[model samples]
Target: MADGGAPTEGRGSVAAAERGATAIADRVVAKIAARAAREALDGVPEGGAPPRATVTVHHDVARVRVSLELDYPSDIGGQCGAVRHRVAERVEALAGMDVPEVAVQVERLHSVHSRRAAQGRIR
Candidate 1:
């Protein structure tokens, strides 16, 4: 008998199967994805929102979706690819979950010229 009359063969002798598992929360994984996206980008566009992420984890697999704003006149495809790679890598490394899919959604684009024009700074 161990503490509180719990039956135990010996101290620190619990079976691995019975020891249970560590579960990482979905929100935590999402945060990791978002941060990783930010790391991949050269810079967040001025007046643009930062990266945001949401994820669904099931049986050690995580499917992530990231929404972000970018600057105009950039290699949008390359940027999106970098974000996808980084998010998957970080999520798997930090959460120990397999990331099979990372869906990148471009919520908006911020252009300096547009901003300047709209603000009457551009002649």
Candidate 2:
């Protein structure tokens, strides 16, 4: 009866229907997570390029995989942990999705000297 003869079901159904087909795209979540991860890695002295993120969403849950370039001689476990925690928090807060899993893949490692050398800044 509401909105031109569109039958409103029960109260729960009516509320759900009123919400409409709202969906947060996977890419949006992925980008959010990626940004969070990058921010989390900002403290690393030898941080390299931006990470690559792949996210898959099912209903309200999202699975994210991030490929990162980390510096050698760093706390890999701690950095990865920070990335996972930040990504999940950002995805949940920004995208309103439950992040059940965040798989971090270390794509490459670079030492401090090597990093400077790669940028042609060696003395």
Candidate 3:
């Protein structure tokens, strides 16, 4: 009866650790997303805009999910793959967690030509 409390305390400690890990995972996801966005849009005019991204952390054993809304060009599969790899590397390095997957969602496509047309600079 006296030793029963020890197991409860241990379980509580484990729970606390799990919570901490989750928080770390969330932060890692945000950092990776920001980095990936910056790298992907490097040298672009609107690259400085704040990234529109949503990051969700799962259980400690699972991978994190990052959804990004960005204007991309046609044939963006290569760029998307690069972004995923870069982000996963950063997250794994920072959080010491394995990222089994990274899902990239292209919300829109923006081109200089389109921008000029929209701004009335071109027909």
Candidate 4:
């Protein structure tokens, strides 16, 4: 009876350890994702607007989804592509994790004029 109980206890410990590891991984991933977003936005003008971005991590280890609303140049298609590539590369490099997919959703386009007004400034 003692030997059988020892095995059960070991298994329970292993399960708890696995859960802890997963929680740590999730936190690491979130930090990586936030860093990636900031890096991708580097060199881009914020127009004095707050960040409008959201990142979601899927249950699958190698997948991340980002939604962003930001200001970009008029010919923005290319810029959008660059943003995605930069974010993917940054997260993969910093996190040391394989990012099989990164889905980017552009939620809104911000205007400098509107942003200035919102800041109570007159052009």
Candidate that would win on TM-score: 1
lDDT of every model, 2 decimals:
0.93, 0.86, 0.59, 0.59
Writing each residue's lDDT as its tens digit, candidate 4 over 54-111 gives 3445554457666666674454666557666776787667665567776766667878
Model 1 per-residue lDDT at 43: 82
Q: Ranking under TM-score, best-scoring first?
A: 1, 2, 3, 4
Model 1 residue runs over 4 Å out of place are 1-12, 119-123
How displaced is residue 41 in candidate 1, in Å?
A: 0.6
lDDT of 2 by residue, 1-123 (tens): 667766667733566556778788888888898899899895534556788799999989999999999888789999999999999998998888899899999988888877667789645
Model 2 RMSD in Å is: 5.2
Highest lDDT model number? 1
Question: Model 4 residue 85 lDDT?
Answer: 79
Model 4 reaches what TM-score against the true structure? Answer: 0.55
Error of 4 at 64 (Å): 0.9
lDDT of 3 by residue, 1-123 (tens): 247654454543555556553356466567666676557654334532444445666653335444444444545777667777877777677666677777776655557666666779644
What digit string (tens of lDDT, one per residue) describes model 1 on residues 1-123?
567776666676787678899998999999999999999999889888899999999999999999999998789999999999999999989899999999999999898789878889645
Show model 4 residue runs off by greater than 4 Å: 1-24, 43-60, 116-123
